[model samples]
Each structure stands twice: as structure tokens, then as C-alpha cells.
Target: MKTQTAKEIADNLYTGVVSRFGCPRVLLSDRGQPFMSKIVKAMCEILQVTQHHTTSYHPNTNGTVERQNHTLAQSLRTYCNDTHDKWPSLIPGIMMAFRRSVCATTGFSPFYMLFGQEMKIPFDIALEPKDSLPQDTRVYIDQFLSNIKMSHKIALQNEAAQKEKDKVRHDQTARVRTFAIGDLVLLKVHKFPKGQSRKLCDKATGPYRIEEIGPNYTYGIRRISDHKKQASLVNATNLQPYIRPDPTRQRLSQEDQNIPPDPDSDSDSDPEVDQDDEVTPNVDVEATQQPTPTPQQTPDPATRYQIQKVLRGRRKHGRREMYIKWLDGSCTWEPDTCFDQEMSDFINSRWTKQGKRRKSYFN
Candidate 1:
């Protein structure tokens, strides 16, 4: 098939897939132009179908499609004529063979799973002769319905077992990652066109904050600078934790730590020197002796809110809301317009703690 435009894709998905199988609860696709288009988004919204995009550069997130493509290619290579142009003609036969064969993931043929019976190929016809006499239509119908129910029950059980086994194998190499709502993250980029120097180009983008998390590790993210805007969905593997810098705190200099103590200071005086000449050392006098601890400033009681977190943006609601988690274990949803500059800065500070450095986006 020729490459389709976004509108074409949206129409095909609705008519070809949805019409046949009904609208799915969730639709998963890569971040392709067709999938990410406005029309597709509208279609999903209207259908109430949650759309999920796989992490860029991580094809394994859409492994089912990839695996099927591989299988199809192998089959075509094995059966196609020398010219290879005849491959398209062989598709129906190849699909039938595949449907009639046992699937490794389900332990059952697609025909059996769907229709609750084996496909009546020519081989089956040759083995068993059909009875011409028709009788007891009601009893035959009841028995057929019962067999279908039993077959479906068996298929479901087999599918569950196969899934557990697959999960065990998958988990062996899978790394667990944790992310909080409103946490800034970097997303991997892998869709650059051909012939560009990848080493020189940026491999990832964003410091996007998590707006919402959906099913299957998919997250809705918006630019950290513009959290008020709508966000895009990205899978978990593409996102990595981003630690926003705190400008309020100052870092101690290593050069100052290595400097020798001042010899002229009264604190450097020997035991033979008079006690009256000895001076009280200042806490900031790092070059003299061990630095004294600075007294902690008491925070103002009225302004002291222990915990603060930004939940998400108010893109579509018209009224902006910032959901916060407090230290008292209470969660409150507050209007963003209510926050002053100080409160806004305080919430942004929670994006990263003091002195913690974040990893590079590409890595």
C-alpha cells in the first residue's frame, strides 16, 4: 500500500479496524505523523479511546507489530517467486496458513480461537465425508453454541498462561523506573531523516514535565516553561528524570577548601600567647580552623508549608489548577492564579531538590 496521509489513516483506522473489531479501549501506535495528527486525536476523543504512543527509539514497546512484520517478511522470502513482484499475490494464502497454524503466544490457531473450530481445508474434507441428512437443527445449534463458549474459555486460560511466561522472560532485563506527576523529564528522539550526522545532532529533547500518566506507562507531558499548555503522550522508556537546578543555594568552592589558613589570624596564636589576644572565630572563616556550624534560620510560621508539588496544567479547564501534595499527607487542588511569585518559585523548587545534579537527556 502507498504511504497514507493523516486523514486517510484516521479514516482507514475507523472503517477498516474499528468497523470490523469495534472501537478498542486503548489504541497504541508509534509517534508517526498519522498517529499524532490533530484528526487522529479528535477521532480518539470522540470515540473515547485512549491513545498511547510508544517511546521513540524503543521499538520493543510495539513488539507485537514488529514481530508480525518480521514473520511476514520471512514467509514472503520463503514462498515468493524469483521476481519478488508476486509476493503481494501470495499474502492471502500466507495469512491463511498463519491463521490455521498454532500461535506461540496463544497456543491455539487463530481460526480455532475466533470460530471455535478447526478450518475445513481440502485435507480435512478428504479425511471426513459430510453427512447429507439434516435433522435436529435446535440440538445442533445448542451444541455449537456450547462448544464455542468452551473454546473461548480454554483460549482465555491459555492466553493468561502464555502472558505470565512472557512477562517472566521480559522482566529479567527490564529496568524499573519511577516518575512523579509534574516531574521534568527528557524524551529520546529517533525520527531524524536519513544522511544527517547523528553524532552531532541532539539525540533527545525536553525538560517536559509530566502532566498525566495513563495506562501502560504512557505519560502526558508539556514543556516545563509552559505547563499551562496541553501536553503530548510519551511512553515511559523515552522519558528520563530531569533535575531542575536551584539558583537560591550556593555551591562551596573546591579551590577555597584547598587554601591554607591565614597565619596573621589571632585564632592561629600558639598556647604561649596571651588568652586576651585570642579572637572568636567567625563561622565563615573556612581557612583558619574547622568551620563552625552556622545556626539554622527559623522559617516563618505563617509561610511555612512543608511539602509542595505541582500536579499538572489547566490546559483545557479554562481555570488553572495546580494539585499539591503537602507534608501533612493532605492533597489539595488549588488554582494557579492564586499563587504569588514566591509560591510559584517554591513549587518550581520542588522540581528538583537542592544540590542534586541530573543526567544528560540523551543518555
Candidate 2:
């Protein structure tokens, strides 16, 4: 516990669980270096314990452990001396108190659930009467077994009810988002260089293309510029659709257009041109000059690309966007305003046939 080295962590795990309770069937932990290192893996293999890790950068997968850690930290802060050097020695007392405390989800203390009886604290021993144990070992074993079974059943029911309440609370603000393979997205930056100000640095940094879709809202992404894949799969919560800027708007803004000078303005007239030099025999020249053919209408560059299909839709920052698959087999996300009335109608018809709600853009 003094250091987070792989050997130390593995030693502590073996001493803590194997010595106290025995080898567990499964070990769930975050993707920390100490937990994922070869030393820990070897230990788990030797103990025949299956190891599972939470998703990268996602702490909610191990929410129960995280919450307990938070509680432990709060307790340490409250009870530790001003120097905080003795905080490590107080962990055992805090842990015991926690195990005896009733959990809101299970509605029963962990001690009672595990041992089939409430723990006898100093206060209870002094103030409350203790019940006598059964004389026969068989009778006591049957009672303990029955109590354990009944307590487990009730605790499971309470846990289920609590989970439903939590789900409902979460669903009130949760939005469903899905991504397909080849979709472009921005990956959130979880770490910055040491001494760099996080507030000034960019929060998200990628125009990464999704290479593969995985279970549990995860995706394997690669950088678009270099095609370099990420080392670990990224969760959906840390990615946003990458909307490419319109090239037409940028081109028009950058290029200067020629404008004819005002004929009536004094600035247009050449004061040095003499009236005698202006010959009036320009009628023949004017008659010979045929009317210039009207310039052909140039097609809009924005509409040149043909859309093959509308793959999906999502709302980001209050703006609705559709994932468009072009005829050339390329894909990108476009806003609702980008589509003309005819294109909007076509998209709506396709979506309606697929049993999706109608988009309100054209209407």
C-alpha cells in the first residue's frame, strides 16, 4: 500500500483478499497500470481468478468502488490529524464502520448479509441484551443458513427497486447516440502535458475516423490525417461527430470579386480627356459589335455532390444533423439547412418509410 508498483499492488491484493476471504471467482478493476500489469495477471492466473477491467477513461463502470473510495477519503479527511501522516492507520476502523453501515440499495448492513447476524459493537454490548446461542450445532447451522437465504432474497429485491429508481432518474436527461463504422468524430482529451493549463488547452482533439464498432457503446477510432489508430477503444461519451466546414463559404470569403465602377460618380470620369478627341463616328462600330451571348449559369458547387442515402440522424448542441452517404461511397454529417426543399422531401420520405419521425427542416 506504500507504493503503486505492480509488485506492491499484487502483494496487497493477495494479502488482503486471499488471506481474509479466499480467492474470489472474479476480480473487477479499472484499467490502471498496477492492475493490468503482467505481475497482477500472473497472480490472478495462479489464483484461478478471472480478471475484468472497466472501459478506458470511463469511471462509471466501477461506480460502486469509486463511491466507496470517495466515502473513505471523506472519512480520512475528517478524522486524520492536522499533519495527515497517520491517515493510513485509520483505514481499518473506517472500513469496519462502513461494512456495518446499512447500504441504501440493499437496505441491510454488509456485515449482516455476510455473516447472517449484525456485528456486536461496543455500544451494543454495553446497552443491549445478547441472545443465547443454540446448544446443538445442527440447530444453529440450520438457523444461520435459513437467515442467510432469507436476507439475500430480500436484499436482492431491494437492490432491484433501487436500480429501477436510479435508471428512471438517469433517463430523464439521457439521450441515445449511436455511430456506424467510418464515421468521423472528435476524441476528447483526458490528459494534458505536465505544467500545461487545462483551461487554455483544447478539450477535444481529433478528426478521427471510426474504424470498428464495438459492444457497449465503444468504437475503435483512427486519426484522419495520419490514419493512426488509438491504443484503446474509446467510449461514445467522449466523442462528438466531426462536422467538416463548407468549402464554398470559405472560398467565397477568401476570393475578391470584381465590381464595376459607378458611371455617374465623378471619380469615374477622366478630367484630362478633351471633348475634341471624342469622335462621334462610333455608330458603325457599335452596330458591328454583336450582342454578347448571355453567360451560362454555373451550377452550385455545394449541390454537385449527389447524396446516395441518409444513413442516420443526431442532435448536437441543439442542432439537428444527418449523416449523408454520397454516391462516391464517402460519408459526412450535414446540417438540416444544407438540404434544399426537394432533397429534404426525399430524405423525409426515406426516413418515414423506415418508421422514423419526420424532420421539420423543410416544413
Candidate 3:
């Protein structure tokens, strides 16, 4: 298509489908603006076509089309390397070549699969005699039907076998990771815009809290600092756990260090003597030696609590409650509303739209 406008996309879609094979029962596409636009939606609705979108940013859901596009692009680049401006004109010839070639997975050319016979090219016409057509029309029709049926059956079996092999190969190196609602994770950054150095840019950016666990290993994540949710659901492949630092260990280490004695005071010095020549007041020595009781410091309501991890979450009386493990070695079942703004954002990110609650634990 010349332009990606909704009108252009809708026109192309109508011409491509309705003019040829008629409206399909279902239309599956990515979450592109043109595919999701009102025009295309209205068109589908009028035709009674069920439209479905692949998971955002996950191309494997629509892998077949994606693979076809990749093959087409490679073919175009090879044929149109010197004639860049005329690449569009070369598409028909490239597509014909692709359709006539035998596919590894199906063990049949697309042309043969569609028409129940091999497509005759210029080379075949020049080197071989043309086969005579069947004299009986009924015989020809029956033979053609049988050939197509057998081809389709074998193709399906071959496709399934290829898929099994692909799955086995994929599983050999695949690492599975899962995140629960309220777990902090770093989102992988995939795009670096023009004029930006990819090496200088961060590989991932987040400390985003998972709000919902979705189908196909996707997670709804929101930034912890800004409380802004990601526009698209992030795939598990692009996420890594964000391990929060332990404040208790740091505090303990600080307490364990010994403080050097003051240089100005000596242990052998008299207890009542004044350093500046002023006489000390007459008071009970034991009372003077007694250590004053230090008041316990209360936690500030405005302070953002360092969450070590979220242990469990649940919806209680229309409000979300979380069992949080704090960095200070304290665990509490606090209502979502009790947290400050940033903490509240983190808590809110863990709840799904359906309000289903699950227990999340650290690995």
C-alpha cells in the first residue's frame, strides 16, 4: 500500500479479500493503527467478520505472515539492489517465483497445492512436451478433486511434523521465566531512534511493577516512579526481575562499626573536671553517669517505603491489600490506600482489571 492511512488500508483490505476469496470468517492482525481503526472495524462488522489482534509487541502470534514478509523483503532486496526506485514493479515476478518454489515444510509448491498440478514455467515449456488433457470432463474433474484432497492431507501432516521439530529445537535453548502481579521487573528496550547511539542507551528501563499477568506470558507493567502504565503488555522474554536492595543489612553494617573515642577526652581524666576551667555542678555521680533513654522514631507517613518484595496480594472488602516484606525486616498486611503516592502506584500495578488476586514470592 502507498500510504498507511486507515482509508487506504480499508480499501486495500476490501479489494484483497472480498474481490477474490470473499470475506474470511476471521481476520487476525497486529495492533497497528490502520488494523485497529474505525474504518477497518466498520468494514469487518458489515461483513460479519470476527477481528482479532495478536498480543502487543509479540510477533510470534502472527509468525506465518511475518515469515512470509521477511522472505518477500529478502527477495526484493536481491532483485532490486541496483534499481531501488523500481522495487515495487518487481513484486509480482518475485511472488510468482516464491509460489512456484517447493516449500521445505509442506514438500509441495504453493502453486501445486492450490491448483492440484505443478505450474509450467518457461524452462519446462522449452525442454518438455506438453501433456494431453483428459478426454472425459467427468474423469478430469474427479481426478483433480482427488489429487487436491490428497495434497492437502499430506501438506497438513508435513506442516505438523515441521512444527514439532521447530518446537523441539526452540525448547532446547528456551528459558522460562514468570512474573506475578506486584513483582518489580526491568523492561527490555528494543528501539533506539535516529541520531542516538544504541551502546550509550540503556538496555532496559523499568523497576516497573507488574499489575496483571496475561495470557501467552504477557504482563501489564507500570513505571514505579511516574505511575504510568506501559502502552503495550510486555512479553516475559523482554522482562527481568528488579531486585530491591536490603536496607536492614546496610543499617546493621553501620551499627557494627566501632566509633573511635574522642581525642579531646582521656579515660584517665577526672570525671568532674572541666576542660575550659569551669567547675562542674554538684550532683550525684551515679545519676550523672546514667544513660538517657532514646525515644523510638516513628515512620513518616510521607516517606516511600523500601519494599523488599510483595509476598501476597488479595482483594478485601472492595479494597486491595498486600502482604509486603519491607527492607527493614518487617512484614505487614497493609491496605493499598495506606501507601504514599509512589508506593500506591506500585501496589496498584499488581492488581488485574478482573481483580483476581494471587500470592507472589521471590525466587
Highest lDDT scorer: 2
Q: Which residue pairs show collisions in model 3?
A: 211-349
lDDT (0 to 1) per candidate: 0.71, 0.79, 0.78
Predictions ranked by lDDT, top down?
2, 3, 1
lDDT of 1 by residue, 54-164 (tens): 765568778889998899999999998888888898899888888899987666788887777778888889999778898798988887788788877877888899889
Quote the lDDT for 238 in model 3.
Answer: 88
Q: Which TM-score value belongs to model 3?
A: 0.66
User: In candidate 3, residue 289 scores what lDDT?
Assistant: 35
Model 3 / residue 307 / CA error / Å:
32
Q: Candidates 2 and 3: which is better by TM-score?
A: 2
Better of 1 and 2 by TM-score: 2
After superposing all C-alphas onto the true structure, candidate 1 shows an RMSD in angstroms of: 14.5
| Model 3 regions lying over 4 Å from their true place | 81-83, 126-134, 192-196, 249-363
Against the true structure, whose TM-score is highest? 2
Sliding window of 10 residues with minimal summed lDDT for model 2: 288-297
Count of backbone clashes, every candidate in sequence? 0, 0, 1
